[model samples]
Target: MKSILRLAAATVCAFTLLALQAVTAQQVQIEGSVNLTPFEARGITLSTLYKVDGEFAGKQGIAVPAPFTLAAPRRDGQQILAQAKPAGGGPIKIYFATDDPQKRIFSSLQIIPFTMKTDDPQKRLEIGDYFAIDLLKKLGENRTTRVNLRRQVTVGGLPAAEVVGNFVNAEGDQLLVRLVAVAKPGSPHGIIGIAVGHPRQGRIKKVEDIYDTSASLAFDTVTFN
Candidate 1:
């Protein structure tokens, strides 16, 4: 009888833990096209290109996404043409709304989403971990270095307080580092992969060589600490 009571207690504990997690979990929604490149979480993100521009198509409630293009026609003064539909694989739902980029929704219109792998605010990128890019300075020869980076910013898009760091270009050249900004927490490919070339020095002689150039590197994939 004692053993049976212990087993029952364990079962209750398991169910309680699961219920708590379900309530505390934070959901993250990824946006953009299925092939938005680098955005592995991409599915069928019906960009606001159509609705945002004040366009509408189809009759009443219908979501049209074919050829997976960002073409939205306008009708009357409607925004979203119709209710969104699934592209193919099931994970997210897309819809039309004018002011949603700054808002969060949790119904069917979650066009693209990924459950937040982790939410520890402190588990983020350190300062000066990324590279600065001033395409204007390197436009002529398309070559820049760790010494040329302009500024640093947090991956959250907030400006960083300092402009100090370095990275090597693909051509074995040291690059002054200025992180464009820290990458967001749930970024699948937010790490800035850089490759610099001079006229025809062979775009990045080798992948490993790029890492060899003087610089720093930090990363936070799905498994955020």
Candidate 2:
């Protein structure tokens, strides 16, 4: 009788283990695939375009993925300014709020094109700092410190640099930024992907997604000049 009872307990444990395995398998299946889009500049391709599981929108030179819906595409001189928002939602106009609704506030992704030879960390920071200056100028404000920097990182197998930090504008509103500079070896021109987050308490979560998405960005096709 003791032997039979021991055998029954063993059977129960086996079934429980199988049930846990099944749950784990289901979770792995639900996590979606990584999807990326391509971007081009100056008749040459650059490794500075990417995203996950989203559709692309915007007309003309400004092309970006969804959840980043653009109101319209306009070029401010050589720079392209596209007012973007999440789909199925209105413009993210609220600056600082405490909920998901406010989190969708209007944000923009600014792409700047330039040519550089090296992929050094300090050089990348300088480039990123220059971008911050341009961004602040666009907002008609200045002064940003507390920069978070990363270096020697690869974006789609190409060397890249990333900087994330915040700055207070003229209105005393804080704006978070995640900017990545991607450089492909032997290419004269490189591209920078900047996603500026709305100044709010819970904006970090979404801003992180944008940063992660951009890390996988690369040109779909490359052409040499």
Candidate 3:
């Protein structure tokens, strides 16, 4: 009778283990078929463009529509200014929140063309990472005091990189800077970079706030020709 009981207990344990394995297999199959990244699962779609007067309007080939107004151009007839002799590619386009350089917030956009093929998502992301780091360096010019955040993100359905840091400008004022670089969707030979800078204690107090505002106003609304 004792031997019979032992055999019964072993059978029950085997069945329980089999049941657990079956459940785990099912879960794995479900996850594989419905794979989703955290950002995608959260339904975050970043864009900087909006419609305005039935026409898209933003600097650097991006625009937006009504109910979304961009920061006032620095001065009349100079809403968009070009920065000459950029590190590479075409001149960088800049838009300022105010005319006063001491207390103003500014954002810039640039399109950098590349010769390498970037059809693969991973390759594109790698290129974007490189551009992002390069952009940060150009912005800081070796005077960065602290870096707050630097990580990968998805922008307009493309892999991108974002960097936020604090640096002292030529004017000797500490400024917060946010930069993002992403491969242009459907365009394998180009990358788009967007950057924002403001006084460290300016109206926008948080680095993430700066990033979010730029995304909604300029980065998210970009459209390439």
Candidate 4:
């Protein structure tokens, strides 16, 4: 009877351990610092464009090129266009926007090829997340004031992360920035989508609404090719 009781107790313990392990596996894991200073110090810039294509086709007349397709919303009574630029030796960076400074909203897509030394999915995600933040900083041309959101998300059926924050541009104009980083297991590249805007009120609800619509559209509509 003693041996039988011990076996039953062990069985319950084993099941409990398995349940805990399953829960942990389901949680999103972020493997790197969320700070932006280190990345900024690297002096990465997306300013120069090696290629420019004015032809925008499909919904709202703006479509991003291969590896992924992003359909960004049009604003400010202007025709939206997708622009392409080289990211040094990395994959080309493609973006969509109008030149209306008053509207102050744009979205961009970038694909970064993975190196053998950092090929793990988690590692790729970490790098992708930082890259997304860097894109936001450069696009806004602002210094980050505060980070409001940093959480796990899914984009295009792939594991991803979203970072939203407040920034101040050179002229002291407040801005809102949102970025999503996505990585597919076993794939050789990670993708990042960035959205930037200038908020009139800067309220939390306003920020959420703008990001939920604009930033969400930038990443949620992604189609992998």
Point to the candidate with the largest lDDT: 4
What's the lDDT for residue 220 in model 2? 15
**lDDT comparing candidate 4 with the true structure:** 0.44
The reply for model 1, stretches above 4 Å from the true place, is 1-116, 126-163, 167-172, 180-225
- Lowest lDDT 10-mer window, candidate 3? 15-24
Candidate 2 lDDT over residue span 157-177, tens digit each: 555666666556555656666
TM-scores for every predicted model:
0.20, 0.41, 0.53, 0.52
* Cand. 2 TM to true fold: 0.41
Better structure of 2 and 4 per TM-score: 4
| lDDT tens readout by residue for model 4, 11-44 | 1122110000101212221121112221122242
Q: After aligning candidate 2 to the native by TM-score, how far in Å is the CA of 59 from where it should be?
A: 8.2
User: How would the candidate models be sorted by TM-score, starting from the highest?
Assistant: 3, 4, 2, 1
**Candidate 2 positional error at 53, Å:** 20
In terms of TM-score, the best-performing candidate is 3
- C-alpha lDDT score of every prediction, in listed order: 0.25, 0.35, 0.42, 0.44
lDDT of 3: 0.42
Clashes of each: 22, 3, 13, 0
Angstrom error at residue 111, model 1: 23
Clash pairs (backbone) in predicted model 4: none
Tell me the lDDT of model 2 at 205.
59
Which structure is stronger by lDDT: 1 or 4?
4
